[model samples]
Target chain A: MIDSIQIRDFRGIRWGEVDGFKQLNLLVGPNNSGKSTLLEAIYLGCTAGQPAHWEGDSFEPAQVSLSGRDFLGDLPLLRVLKRHRYHLRKAGQGPYRDGCLNISISSPAAPLRRFQLHVPDLPILPDSLRDMDSKISRIEIDEGAQVALFACASGRDAGRAERALAGRILQLLSPTQGAGSTRQKTVQSGHKTPSGPNKQRRTAQRGARPSSGTAGPGQQTAIPRRPPAAQHCIYLWYPDLTYHSAGVAAWSLTGKLASPEHVLFFDVSNTHYHFYKTFLRDTMTRVPGWTYKIADCLREVLGIARSFDFHVQFLPAKDNDSLIQGWIAPRDQPALPIDAYGDGTRTALKILASLLSLVEQATADSPAVLLWEEPELFQNPRMLNRLLREIARLIEGKPLQLFMTTHSLEVVACVAMLVREGLLPADSLRAFRFSLEEGTLRSSWFHADNLLSWLERGMDPRIWDTLGVPLQFTLKEQEEGAE
Target chain B: MSAAMGGSIDAFYEGMTEKKILHMLMQRGLLAKVNLCDGKETGKTEVNRRLRDVVGPNVGTKQVRCLVLRDLDERETMERIKQGLQTALQALYRERGHPKAVVRFVRHRAHGNVYLHTCTELDVRVALHIATYRHLPDFCKSTIDDYVLRVALHHETAAALIKRQGWSISSKRIIHKVTSEIPALLKQNGIPMMGEAKDFIHFYAALLRVHTSPAVFAEKILHHAPESELREVFAPLRAAAEFLQDASSPSMPGDRLPA
Candidate 1:
């Protein structure tokens, strides 16, 4: 579990640091305050060297960003995300330029298990997309040297960026061969000795200069950057996609980011909502046993009295493919199509199922992470309360850490109440408030103690910054005004 | 927000009464147009925490002028104001994350006031204005009711509110208590002056005996309190408001307050 997270110049956040994550980390703030962006940064940080997005079919709007064939590398993503960024010219000053973005996530329990991603605000990705390779990500626990992220515009660029990353990985792990990065094809390669002094000197030298075009937190110390023959670097990440084990073979990642939590960012942004069906279809095919568990979770959280069996049915397609259909078949009752249920149900199912799967696959060594955004979406207060309790229950004693974001202060209160009731661990809920300005996105993290205190004293911890001020919401025509 | 973004001032007050009162002053152009965020009565620590919370959104943008109106639940005097709240202010920014931060109460030749100002490490200019709400500035430390009574009882609107129904203060007993009983009560307490923070406590106690709802009574007085009276009695709030409006350094109240 990533107990702490720090991001500087990632999306709308110029500089933000929030720690004290429990099993459930709550990101609470107003709109445009960079709560969602914080989640995205964690997701990207943990999954460094992995493709940040997969656009799938251009025509298919429902196609999720992290899946399918059309993967987008750093340059392409920069193209998509460049406009949302600004240049923090000074400390808490200046318009957000396309400056470098860095994200560092660490587990306090496992201090060495850290993942840092730094994408240098390269001048190259802004205009021309066809030529650049996004070998920019450096994940040195901190370089990735955390994300030396290079940019590539399309799938065509992905292939090139992938090889460049693999070659850089080869150079970092094996200095003898890394010295040959200018000539050697680092793909399909085996392990070599880790040269501590050589790597340390190079890393420190690179780390010496902070956000310059030439220097950074040196992670992969020896990769000759932007080589002419970028294509001949290596082809390694493709085979490593399924390589989700604790043992990281080769990549910008050296020891792996946190024994490597199977980091999954469950984003519910309007465009990315289509993945629930895809998730259900895959789960039914691979782990049909999870159906009953998911059903039980859904039933208990939704306060449904009756038992049900969550299932996905297959039908013959016009092109001889099996068209998958999902259903919620209640025990001793007629089967109902999953489509008949509301988005809240599906969203819960997605979360519950993912939790179950991750928990089942997780071990003491490698815990799983679920980066859930907007858990309150379409959820009534009662349902939300139940769902939160259910989540706490599901992850109890299990190796699963949930980092979820919600615009609802109700969620913070609910979690506090849960901790109060002993349904959730008292120390395991960290509520962070993100307040955004021009060159800064400030994060204030609250422990259970603060939450309980705020609630007890009639303070709304969610808007702590505006608590003593007369904002529109706090400014009310109440009986207290007479005082 | 840089130069492109407009500036903003937000005041963090202890209770809804202070909020409505400040907002009332803002509406009357007696104070700056401040975003008044009401605080829970968790005391001094909560005030400092809330100030810390507002620092971030302004750290990298156009600096947001902050005015903290925490009712430390005590009466203020010029000696205490002059001694400076640097220790308290220093405690606020001394947390681990605030790097090389320094807090200084604005050095001033101004009178004994309830307000203090300091810049945090992030350079968030925050001014802390003490909300002195007491039954008697010398006697009992109390709620925002004291602030209401202190400012409003001096205004002619207090008599109007006494006569108004459902707005509290109904009978001749209450009117006598406000106009006659309160003065006699203060005299009974061996008090020589009327303007101390303690004096409001006596008036509030009299109104309390009449079953006057503090919130309702405060609202009526704030709404109907004359411009001149507010400018005079609420000069501290107005000072902080004006400080918020200006781009220059923060200034303390030049006017004196009874210890």
Candidate 2:
């Protein structure tokens, strides 16, 4: 688990720092309090090494380039060689000097890596000045050490360095997090490159003598490779009026729709009413004419009640395009010819399908984390409450870790109701208050009760009138006295 | 003179007869003295005895020591009876929390002189008198200027005040002379006559009352000014009154002006 993160001179933060997290962490603060910024920072740092298929496509080595001048500014030899002027002035030991980024990380379950990237400031040169031979700079993890990878026009040391660097980075990526405690071996065993093309000439150039221990044969070396674990992120927001009263269902099912590897996807436009129907159907036996079982596993997971095995047909995306194309479930569902249903059926089907999918996942050992934003859209208050309760019921039976974000009092109230009914762990439930302080994003975490109180005092008072809910407390003392 | 019985109107007129009874009662050295008539008609003797019993020491009375009845003509008596009852009740109040009561009454003419001829002790009389005066403070800070200003502002009628103060000069002449010298009065006090004339009169009258009797003060200063001039001179006072009215009146901001 990543413990703490400190950032400086990055976007939206000067001296930003935040810490304290558990298995299921939450970020909440006022708008522009940098909650999202913090999440992005973690995403960037972990982007370093994710390539293997077992780890999934999420952790591929995306390209991010740094210019050659940064190295000239960071290294001591380049400083004197280039006679960079800006470095001298900003050499002071303050946080935001000319060039310094010392990042420290600690993870007991994973390897601890420190990345200190710096840039040196160069003197201003005339506009016309240009160097034809100057090369674009690159940084690479080489033989367990950070080495400057340069691409010269001449391509002199390119071939050897490329092979060595690629091998080293690959090794760095392949280490298992926890192997039987025999001290797994490092990927690089002091690999050195020949300075000159002639092997004897390179040996003569470096007169070194240090006896090094050799690795026993058939010993498993620990490569720095772990499946880029599903990056659990919950992006919650109070949707616009268009999405108000919209029931949201999203999960990544890792398999084909028909095969055992298949996972279901259901998107509902208005989830409020449908959630109740699905919830009742799941908990209670339906009457003979009202319900039928779909032997097709995918259809069942999708919560499509089928009258007969042959009658089971995949519905077209016409009715479910927006509903199915939600956050988590990748949009690959084959479209069938079906008219867009009215809002009531569309919304109900969307929520029912999502709940059905959740019921399927809950049957499994590991359930996908649900990310929902503003599920209280377009529905009456009663519908909103029912949707929340159904969501809670689905969550209660399922092993899935649920993460939802909302600004609606009814939505929060529903979750609180779940908390009140012992459907979810009170402590497990977290509400984050996101706000801006000192031009940086800051957030405070709260449990269900705290979230409820904050909603009542901070949000409900301001928006209650708009919601048509009777003002629980008067807005002004004078009004209260008059009442 | 015939031996007149006490409590009868006849005995009151026959002063020597009542005085003889009083002297005899004093000589006899009774705890309480009473002159009585036989209970043949209206019980004049019984009334006297009852009065003695009410006033007598060790007779259910906790504090009262003496009582004085200043009767007057019927109209005056009725007015004074209310005034006297109110005044006595006020005197009995324990404003300081300590359980002590002293009842006294003052006739209308006794300006600045409160009669505390009660059955209470001398020290009690002095303390109660001081406390009564202390309760009439115009401000937290005690000053002659403040006292004068307070008196001028609160006292309603100049003629009444003059008559009540028992001023020697005719109220009209005093008022006329003070009115004529209004400019000099303002100049003497180093106060500008920027406000209404009534304001000036009140302010000046208050100053005058501090050093002189209220009657002299009012007659000499207040009555000379006409109502219009008084209103003009008391411009600041008018402003203060306007402010008080605005603060008290109930009207919302959006109310339309009357056509």
Candidate 3:
């Protein structure tokens, strides 16, 4: 649903923009082409405010003490802003300049919103302490959330000021509270402060929780519970409403939005056999029907008549810790432990399980984006072909957007052949070849016509050899003595 | 040739055979300026696509000319292959919706030169010379084998071997068998092909080397050739420099030959 994305001074990319994205986009290139970096950038941009959930790390509310780095964990909203400075100058863009890491998203439903975080020069401090700084920064979200800044003094006075500032920022981000309603109560850097009921509410909220284990003796004890007014604040940071709202709107325009799962990424390089089995087991637990679908897909694609069976047994010796065991049952054969299968079979099972899980979660109205990095790992050509075909079916009638990066020519050829054969819609598929040209990252879109022509001529579609000239030879005259 | 003067010739070939031939011709001072294409052949469709891209739309105005050289592959006759190439070119121009042009094929019997001219409506010339080699000529082929034998054995021993063996077996088979038989062929004897012989054998051996065997005589043996032995090996190729020199002359535009 993202029409285009422009990235500048982010990770390895100096400046690059990819426009005219299709439903299913394939980023094909050699290693170090910034494919993974691009995905990371997208993920970061979408989940900007909620950095704790950014890497799928579990959120612990108990980590909200008013001392040390642990307090920073409570306010995940500010973590990404602090990390923005680290992204600066890393792309070889000279000395760090005072520029916001700009992520702009546009949609037909809403006006363009440019989420700008003015990366400050100071090292990242806990939110309780950071409120003392006087530098006023404004982040504008067009027709959406508008963030206003206020300053506070350090020490005991600043702790109360920090809570007030947090409450105010939360007010700004929360959709239920209008920016117009909170205009008169705006606290200035050194002068004005919130008094009366708002201050008392924040003070009460700060006094409810016990001090964290890491909190110092001087630090305030028992941070209070969040007030009901700030309950709607965290919901504003939901990926569905913030980063991927444009995609949601795009989907709505076409009429479908049943599920809220936006993005799923599979990094095959780090996914070991055990790690994959665990992920499959977790998905199967979440969506029980997905297990059967995965089994059917494995049998149809890999020609392996095996069904997954998972059992959780409690161990009394280890204080009743539950251990999950996985078994693969073959038709008319004894059920064997899933670890007995080859890595390829396990990888195939994981991929199919992930796809089935996405399908189970996706609805006609709400579609998800699947980012698969190197699915070709440990998969042979036949398995890859079947996987692609299954993917083609998975996207049918569903609002799923699939993005994959691969170095396999077989995968490229299979996709091209599928499009050529009308198994996948030509318009839905897009291929981009990323290359480093003249010390700058660049991408070229391969036209479907050219790809189909290459396939028709029995040439490797992945190799863009047309950019170079062909070698030639002079004809040899007939030998005099020989026939 | 100075680097400044090295940009004039635009010759495209099917594979390594033409590249070696052109390289040798350049070394021998037969062709002053030549630019050989550096890619492997995919198929006729890709080749035609490349032809249009490299040649550009204004074919008559540009000084750039292309010469396509391919072997007379066993599956097709020389005339049929030539016709197929011409048809492919015409189809490419038509597919691009370019103005129809008169395609004329010319072969000079005296010089053994073949030229295909694609002329505009106004008779402006845009030419592509096509040539096919069934096998390397006897002189070049024999010279390459003799050089290989000399490098693999002592002169008297090589002469005795040639005198005793004669030309009953194929030169490629003879070279393969003799090189394998002599354990010290690569170590004791230096590569015999250098200078002219290196150029000639590279082309000659590559042509015969296609499909029949994976081993290339020039790459395996010539890579081991000592610098001192190069002059003697290249003498014969230098002597046949006139062949390339004769082909470099611009052929008459209107000359038409029977297919």
Candidate 4:
């Protein structure tokens, strides 16, 4: 169990300390209480070894950078970028407060090892806002002799950049040697050598086509990235703008069949809802150890599963713009792709698949760490409950640890139930109530007993409304006057 | 008779040893409560036939005296005592003139039973005894019983203290001069005897008195003497008493009167 966490000058928090985390930790805090900031900090710390500044030049839509003005112009992208900026600043503070994330992890008999994940700020340029033509800057992991893994990216999509880096770090801790990767060869034969006539005719026709040295790499020819021996850490997000049809198609085709070692990342601004569904479906099917039971629970409760392969597309964005999309399954299934299922079912499926993939990837030899932002997005109480219940079950009897940021009480309640049922050891479950107290993010752990008691008495619903505010207020009013 | 009949020849020869001959004679003397004496001056040859049986070889006479006193002066003042042999010898002779003063043992039974002096002095100025009561009335059985009790308590207390402290003092070594030994060591020189409970009250009050009036008792006893002595010497007793009282008190305020 990690004994405690002390953060300094990271996001909304100037300095915050929390002690007593068992194997499982649930952080509860107000929206701005730096709950997500804390998770991002851990991700950064774990993957802080590599330099972010790398070589890549691809002008993609997701890479199109915008200024504070242009970024603000698009409310959805602006909000997304704002959160990224906060993380960047936090990860960059060096002397007085290096924008860095520090993590402390421990085993039963081992001492705590403090690690720092450092990343330099890589701002997207206005010209590259529409086409993501940026690259990673610098990543420094384990700066102080502490164990850390770092990755750097210069992509227009900071979310993908971070996820790619996180995946690299997780690969170091638990290397998955053999499940999803395989090698194969092809053999061709001809009767009587087909020799004279057919062989020469084919050669002569090929030679007549003109020698233009312009052949691109094909899907079948492209060499796959060998699975990293170590376990993986996944970073994911959804499309912020633009149509996601093409991205969604690519996701189900080759992406689904790739090694599970490839951490799932959703740059929503450049991804369609179908991509999420396909990813979920593929993760559920392809991963060696994910299950539909968790999915069923989610569906029964939430009435939705985002990636159940229901073939439904074109979810309305915050700006009221519809991202055109579609879902296609193999001919064997025949019916509309599973993505066609209702939005709720598809959403639930996506959440369950993501959780299960992480769980499956997390074997004893290579356990994984999963991070998710706003897990409660488009989720109702039942769905949220099912999702949390599934997550607890995933880590229930495994070596995997999960970190997530949520603004839903239902999610918190589910976690509390898991803790109460003894599914999670006292030290395993942790929650932080977060809020901006006096212009700064203040955080404290929510004791399970105290939280249940508070819930039993029926807390104000507003705590769920302003994710950061209500939690902060409740925690402050309750914890500040401690006897 | 068995030896005369020759059934056991060893029995006939047993009287040849000095110890056996002396034992046989002592058994015949019936020395149950009486002091025994040996005839050391008798002719060795004339008594040869039964010399070993009539008187053992070693013979000596030691004088012993039993003197009794009472605290009759009633002064509460310190009484000066001194040993004078002439006065003690005359008193003993007057009390038991018919007996020779061979082995003299001086046993005093005043405030309590105790062995008085090892030997009485020859000076006639000695009173040979002191008094709190008028006279040594008759040597009644009740007085003896009281003496035994006094001796037992003193011996027991000393033995207990030695056992408790794991000290080396033997109970036999502590000769009780009077029943007033413990109290006298705790209070001033001429202080009167106060009962156990009254003694504690007086001791506590003396502590209060020392702080209040330091000059009143300075002539005979220092103002701080009683309090200091009581506090230091009786500390264990005082602590035990306090503990007992506290344990007996009811904790609830309203339940003080058993309502």
- Model 2 chain B poorest ten-residue lDDT run: B126-135
List DockQ, one per candidate, in order.
0.14, 0.01, 0.02, 0.01
Total backbone collisions for each predicted model? 64, 46, 18, 119
What lDDT tens digits, residue by residue, belong to model 3 across residues A323-343? 233456655667665446676
Candidate lDDT scores, in order, read: 0.48, 0.29, 0.40, 0.32
Winning model by DockQ: 1
TM-score attained by model 3: 0.41
**Candidate 1: clashing residue pairs, number:** 64
Best candidate per lDDT, number? 1
Off by over 4 Å in 2: A1-50, A53-313, A318-348, A362-365, A437-439, A452-483, B1-259
Model 3's alpha-carbon lDDT is: 0.40
Q: For candidate 2, write residues A1-483 as lDDT tens digits.
A: 233343322234322434333222345433445554454333322221111100001211111111111100122112221221111111111232233222222212112122222322212221111121132122211111121111100011212322222222222222221211123232212112211212111111000111111221221342222212111111111011001211110011111011111112121323321122223343234222211221232233334436323222232223322122211111254432122334433443355444445445343433333434445545556655655555565556454444344545566566666776787777666554444434333333445544444333333311211234464422321111110
Q: Using lDDT as the measure, what is the rank order of every candidate, best first?
A: 1, 3, 4, 2
Error of 2 at A343 (Å): 5.4
Q: Give the Å shift of residue A58 in candidate 1.
A: 39
The candidate that achieves the highest TM-score relative to the unseen native structure? 1
Q: Fraction of true contacts kept, per model?
A: 0.22, 0.00, 0.00, 0.00
TM-score of each: 0.58, 0.29, 0.41, 0.33
Model 1 lDDT per residue over A323-421, tens place? 333467765777765557787776776667667766666665665667787888888888988888888887888776777788776787788898889
